[model samples]
Target: MMKIDLQKEFNDYTQNLNKASKDQHINTAITRAVKAYRSTVAESLERFPHTPEMAAEVREIKTQAMANNSELLAQAMASVERNKGKAFYARDRQQALEIAAGIIGTGKTVVKGKSMLGEELHLREYLEEKGNEVWETDLGEFILQLKKDRPMHILSPAIHVPREQVAEIFSKFFNKDVPPEIAEEVGVVREFLREKYFSAHVGISGANVVAADTGAMVIIENEGNVRLASGAPPVHIVMVGIEKIVPTFQEAMKTAEVTWRYAQYGVPGYVNIVSGPSKTGDIEKVTTYGAHGPKEFYVIFVDNGRSEMAKDEKFSQALHCLRCGGCMYECPVFQVTAGHFGHTYLSGIGAVWTAFVSGGLEKAAPLVYTCLRCGRCMERCPMQINVPAMIGELRNRIVNGAAQGEEPLPQVAHS
Candidate 1:
């Protein structure tokens, strides 16, 4: 893995925010994208009719679900096992990677669906180093994988890259002139990934929500890539944060609904729910696994500081995030810097997430301070996470030179 000084990078990006905001290419991309997103989301919300009452209900469900996290995890694991799937818990990033790699083994071909949790662990790099050929099947993740760049946005990985730049990237990648048109670019990707989907030995994905009652993991996507990636291979591995577990399937669907609703879609194009390894009861009363889709299904519940964060009420709220990209559209700072303003996660919610999940107060300090404290993010959030309030809390903790669960710094004697 590459070494990155989050503090230094944050400082540099903060210093150059003005220049970035003024850059014609960046400004054009962001302005157009944000405008389109806001417009579409407005229409989606209007059409879907998400009432404040519904939002409040979802909030209560998530709060209760999160509060009963341990019980839900145990139930989810039991449920997965009963469905003829293997379930594992990863306490941290290292363990997560180790478990995933052990399942994947080495010298195997793997195709991946876009997964932020996978990104959080740099899973591709780990697999590659272990001698496996892994490809990111999602178009956006594919572009970034080719460019060797981090995701600029959570949902839309290469949102910062203009179409022309993509044309350039694709041209070099394909060893031919690829047109700048979106359709042609998408065609090139589709054609290239078609073979990978069928040939890969393993498929990796992240779940939007895991139902504790049924052990059904829900994946919502506009692109069919997730379905293909998770289905084509004989072995399927799903890694999801523990916070994504909801108490029941109904609540899980509701979570998925609200997530894409605020993510600028009235309904996702595909909603894939996998309870376990593919089974066939067509064999005259005998149940058989591996009939189609993935023969073996594995779910890795990644704790990775979530259990710690869950203990703190304010920080626990960060886990309530639905991973909707809506808040970024409303964030003035993000509109300018794109993903540069964040490290792993993006925007204000990302600040709180980074503080807990990524590193600590020092790492998140730059982002916490960079937040404009504009209430737009809160207004737009599906989870209604009070980002500014959380940021203020982070700032207070940092200013007092205190770490989480520690006493504040002592005051120095003034001369």
Candidate 2:
């Protein structure tokens, strides 16, 4: 199990975030996330001139939900258990991190929301190896969690460091001389995540869509830290991935208006819509639960192989992807391999979601032949989603390819 070096593992995750790829802060964050996702896909195709006829009606509603994925995932798990939401269907990734660390039990304090399915289910090192003080609150995942480092971009996680090395890792982890300035390292990570977004007690997130006719769980961020990690923690998880569900809410608001114009090239003024937890009864308005927010709102629907790529209609159009990091910065091999464009949902549709949620194409088959099939990721794919002809059609359906036997990727011995 060795061969990983996709550019010396992103130059040792940018030298362990002491941050020095001064190729001008990852080319100024891949030129500001590709000029704000190409001015939000040219202002969402000029304020929706039927974005290529609603991306051919979301590719025929993902061609009849991947042509019947177990009766559309049992009608999206009975519409998230008829809206009370407690679905838990994990088929892998350590049983969805032991059912989200057993519904966040022991001594609380989680607060997440930057989720590449909670960092491919590492889930904050398994809830800090069961001790719990999670906290990622997404300012590029709080500067790659103050330099422990891993997310090099699933929508700008410390896009290979360079706000003067994030003002020198916030002047040596907040020992205080910080002024190299990128809006003062975003006001010292917004004055240290506004006291962990009001004293966290468990509020994870990751659901860019899950509307099965309004079980309603969608979040298309511009950073209100996923509406304060699913609204100020009263226990609000959402891990999501049953191909992020869509049988409605107008096809999950056209997959969150083409996933925020394919990740901020525009149109994001907070499109949140989280239907559950945030109760109020104010003077006989009655029917209450937790007047402020998040009073236990779980929704862990994972299916780790995405039901074998939803019964394979050519890897089920990679489950109609909307994780929209814009086919990883328009993959010229992910603009020359940033975060090695293969794993945690990066380029070539994150090598078809790491060959069906972490296992396929074997060490992701030479990162899916470094995709220069160059359809230019289907001309900034809103839903044009070709992904270099599905990584040459899942590298001919992985018959000893995308590497598990090819070897030669090991490098990093820089002591």
Q: How many collisions per candidate?
A: 0, 7
lDDT of 1 by residue, 187-220 (tens): 9999999999899999999999999999999999
Residue 252: error of model 2 in Å? 22
Range of the 10 consecutive residues with the lowest summed lDDT in candidate 1: 406-415
Clashes of 1: 0
Best by lDDT: 1
Cα deviation at 206, candidate 2, in Å, is 1.5
TM-scores of all predicted structures:
0.94, 0.34
Stretches of candidate 1 exceeding 4 Å from the true structure: 1-10, 15-19, 403-415
Highest TM-score scorer: 1
Which lDDT values do the candidates have, in the order given? Answer: 0.87, 0.72
- What TM-score, to 2 decimals, does candidate 1 have? 0.94
* Candidate 2 RMSD computed on C-alpha atoms after optimal superposition onto the true structure: 19.7
Task: Give the per-residue Cα lDDT of candidate 2 at 169.
Answer: 82
